[model samples]
Target: MSLAQRWREARPPVAGVHLDSGACSRQSLAAIDAAVQHARHEGEVGAYVAAEAAAPALDAGRAAVGALTGLAGSDVVFTTGANHALDLLLTAWPGERTIACLPGEFGPNLAIMAGNGFAVRPLPVDDAGRLDVEGAARSLAADRPALVHLTPLASHRGLVQPLAAMSEVCADLDLPLVVDAAQALGHMDCATAPAAIFGASRKWIAGPRGVGFLAVRPDLAQRLQPRLPPPQWPTALSVLQRLEHGEANIAARLGFSVALGEHLAAGPALVRERLAEVGRMTRTAVADLPGWRVVEPVDEPSAITTLVPTGGADPETVRKRLIADHGIVTTYAGVERAPFEMTSPVLRVTPHVDATDEDVARFVDALAAVSA
Candidate 1:
């Protein structure tokens, strides 16, 4: 049996063909059970004491994330999720308010920047929703903005941005790059840290919700003046400590550690390989669906495949029918949610590591029926 096949055996059983991995993955039973067990322990020992015992697991999780992102344990700080992590960074950041990001940047991220009083400038992208590297480079040469934020992969689309190429441009101009790898964290290679990298555990990590981390290049982290609620507890000795508030979620961290352990066991390279294969397979399977435009490029690499309906197929209605009638799951991406380059709604279809060729075929059949 394949690695993903074996991994599937250990996870909680799914109600149906689950293809919304881009939102949250069906977690492993061990991951869930570890959380439950930790909660029980907390009840017996009290939250503070239980947290002390969980320190090792917390450290393990940090190490796992660090290894995955090519950072040291000290460089990582846990947060509630990606949005909160971004808020933390923005709160601490004293850089110039003007920032440059791709046209297809995640809507929530854009909101965070705006709420924090940053002037967001949109960079150009190609037809496939990828960052135009040369264009962006040219713009950077002209503006030399205080920060350049990039989402390595789009939440609503299947395209992977040219992160490395953009990084090189930023590096040359001494421009600070902040990458939101919420979609790419566990599924992509993030070892080479730029200024900061932040993501959630729920998506590709297959970890529990309510948990995520922000990894900073240690040297760069020193520049941050982390925020603390008024009457701040003064024990925070480091950047992560200052950002993290009292009473860590011991159970969630334990669960996240188990999930991280599962990822480590499977090996990052192998997991990414399997995910990319399933991505291409699903894209090919639904390529022939009529009256639909494949928004994601055929050659662009990502586990997400978004299909935009045309000729009377309402994207929202299709999404409802996909789940209600077929027991298949998908996320409907409205233009408002994407807001930058998307003009029409799209359906995000994500195939997982264990998803087989048969799974994609069945999903496509049901999708076709719904669209018709």
Candidate 2:
């Protein structure tokens, strides 16, 4: 089937939810269809064929991600998803490598770093979700970390971190910086420094799921021997050898490549401008709600806007209400705080290029009804 036909068939029938590419226009669908055709002709039919032809798609996808981050194609590595890319990075750099990350980072990334046996350190952030740059610098210098993982924007709260300045710090310290751009890829301009950059196409890029890219500086890439050694080694090491192979998601890769082309054609500035407008409208409509708080900064980095209810209101309650009653879908950040500690639950509302003013207004109305 054509990509357009697939998209039309896959698109959920809903009005107010700000999830799933926010607003998929005709241009986007056409681009995806073209990519689908390209993938078919390229012999990307099944897993075995995909594995054999992985390098080309990997190369192409890397170039696209590099353009987004202002890096060279040689610096990029295509991965199955952001999580898998991160796992590869962490596994390759395991053992007492002091790693510093933002406290309010995306939960899964944090868990992966911890699970991989790195000594994880948290950088302090203000209530506004802005990282203390000086504090981060101090922590990095003191710890002399091998890797510094940061999210340009907090996914849960939609606050923009000072990436340019942070990149400068990493450069000065000669530390490798890995940015989780999963949520910021199309919405913001990422630092082009020789740091390792990771992002997924599923979020803002409006691509199929299970496709992401990782960019490691040429120098760093050379140093990274895969966590698993080569196959055909001794029997004792065969299980470990499998880790060396990088798996590619062929269909999703093609979809992501197509989505990226569409995004580039539209231009990042235009996408950001449209999303910002939707965000502003959403904020304005919900600003007067008595107990609801906008967690995103007044001038946040990207198109994601998060809201939280005061007085310990349950986030799931609001999320379920929005999905069930109004057909609006939103996300909540899960917490893992100690007992007796008060953790703020958050509801995320991400605006996509396809989203319209009507969609934003409907979401606002839904929030008002649920909060009331």
Candidate 3:
């Protein structure tokens, strides 16, 4: 079967054309079943026993995450979600109270850095809001921030950052690079070995919510001293596991593992290629809409496409009407999503690999009808 066919068959029936995979993807049957089965097993044989029984699947999932990010299973740490993962990393950051990041970094991440007592500086970027590698390298060398953070794919725009180039720069400068791959893990290639990488299971991975992971370099892991919550354990775990809390939803981790397996079996390269094609198709199809302009280029590498509404059309109202009147789902990104760079609100359309030409047509027609 084609990849789309397999994906469609694996997922439950959708209420409408789902174009908001950037927020939360539709979960597959395998993932849902794994989570539900684990919950049931917990009821049958106590939660701790069930978790012990689930160790192998969980370990396999960790190893898969490590492989994706160019780390080992032992180096992967689980958390509530990407927010928690970042909190763990920033709390354990073994550096000074300053960091540099892209201007288009996610707004919540900025809040997290501030909450952790780190002063933020914007890295140099081109006019298009992408990392200017040479400029960024020069700025990093001159300023010498304690660390560098990158969001490879911004939530409000489709621009893909030059993570590999930045990684090389950090390696040369011996500056630690922390990556927020919440939107990049399944949608794009994430094997770049930075100092630390973190992401969630709910977005492109199509895994259950409430699961996130952090993979740290071995030497960096040793240096990070995560401020563990009250009631710490006496025995020792792996250095990475120290970041994870003792209590967790084991069932969700199993579901995440199943989703990771499903993504791997479908092949990451194939998935990324199909998503890029869908993105290009969506951008082309929506290019001529009245009073709305595509934010990204016709062939942006990522799957996300943002539209800036013109002529006094409120994107938030349009987003609501798309769901209420047309039964189409999408995201309305306000300046709050990327406060530093976004000048206006935008409509975000992010379809998954299972999206069809008909789906794109439906969205275009629905948008036209609602905006008029």
Candidate 4:
């Protein structure tokens, strides 16, 4: 079957046009069923026994994360969501509480770092808010913050960060790099190695909500050491496993495992290619709408396209009208999503690989009417 056909068959159905994959994609029916089955099994066999039974699937999920993120499953730690994963890493971070990141870093991440007692500093970036690689390397070498945090793809815009080059720089300088791949994974190539990479299952992966992960390099895992003792006697769990909380939603995790399996079966490379095409289609179609400007370049390799409404039209109002009147879903990106870079709110549309030309056209028609 064609990829689109398979994607359509995998999910049940939606009420209306969904153009906010950047916020959350539609979960496959298999993923939903896996979670339901696990929940039922927990009630039948008791939670602990059911969890023990799910070991293999959980391991495979970690392996899939490793395969996609260029780390080992042994170093992967599952958390509630991307925010939780970042908390685990930041709270456990050693040395001086200072970190460097791009100006357009995810806003909540800045809050997390600040709450963890880290002082925020900006890395060098060009006019478009993309990292200036050579300048960034020099800045890192000179300033030498405790570590570097990077959001390869921000929620407010579609510009892809230069992670591979930054990763090389961090490697050469022996600096620890923390990557927020919540928007990058599943939507684009995310195979670069960093000190740690964390993301959610809900976004591009179309996994269940409340499931996220953190994958640390084995060496970094060893360095972080144990904050709390393991629940079991004799401590047989790996370092990363010890970092995981004792209690978690087994059903959601099982669902995430199923989602990971689906993603792998669909093929990550093809999935990315399809998303790029969807991005182009969405951008080209929406750019033609009157009084709304597409923020990202037409060919930017991201599924997300930020739309800035001209003539002072409120993005929040337009977003609400699109949903309430037109039955089309999209998200509004405010300055709070990327405080340093975004001056005002912009509408964000991110259609997944399953999206069709009709979907784009529906959004275009709805947006033009709402804005008019």
For all candidates in order, the CA lDDT equals: 0.84, 0.68, 0.90, 0.89
Give the poorly placed runs of model 3, Cα more than 4 Å off. 229-235
Largest TM-score belongs to which candidate?
Answer: 3
Estimate the TM-score of every prediction: 0.96, 0.83, 0.97, 0.97
Question: What lDDT tens digits, residue by residue, belong to model 3 across residues 51-110?
Answer: 999999999999989878878888897888998889888888767989999988899999
lDDT of 2 by residue, 1-372 (tens): 532234334445445454534222222455456456656756646557655565575467667777888788766666777888888877776345678877676777877877887777777776665788888888778868778888886556666788888888888899888998887787777845646888787777777766677777766665564646533354453221233254555666777777777667667777777667656766766677677788665555466777778756677788899889988777765564211112776676775655556777787778777877
Worst 10 residues of 4 by lDDT: 225-234
TM-score between model 1 and native: 0.96
Report how far residue 163 has shifted in candidate 4, in Å.
Answer: 1.1
- Specify the poorest-scoring 10-residue window by lDDT in model 1: 227-236
- The digit string of per-residue lDDT tens for model 4 on 1-372 reads 878889988898888999988999999999999999999999999999999999899999999999999988877888999999998888777678899999988899989998989999999898888889999999999889988988889889989898898999999999999999999989777788789999999999999999899999988877775555733457776778777957999888888888989999999999988888888999999877778888888998888889998867899999999999988999988899988888889999998888899888988988888888
- Name the better of 2 and 3 by TM-score: 3
Q: Give the residue spans of candidate 4 off by over 4 A.
A: 230-238
What is candidate 1's CA lDDT for residue 26? 86
Q: Report the candidate with higher lDDT, 2 versus 3.
A: 3
lDDT of 3 at 44: 99
Q: Write the per-residue lDDT of candidate 1 for residues 79-98, one digit (tens) a residue.
A: 98999989999888877788
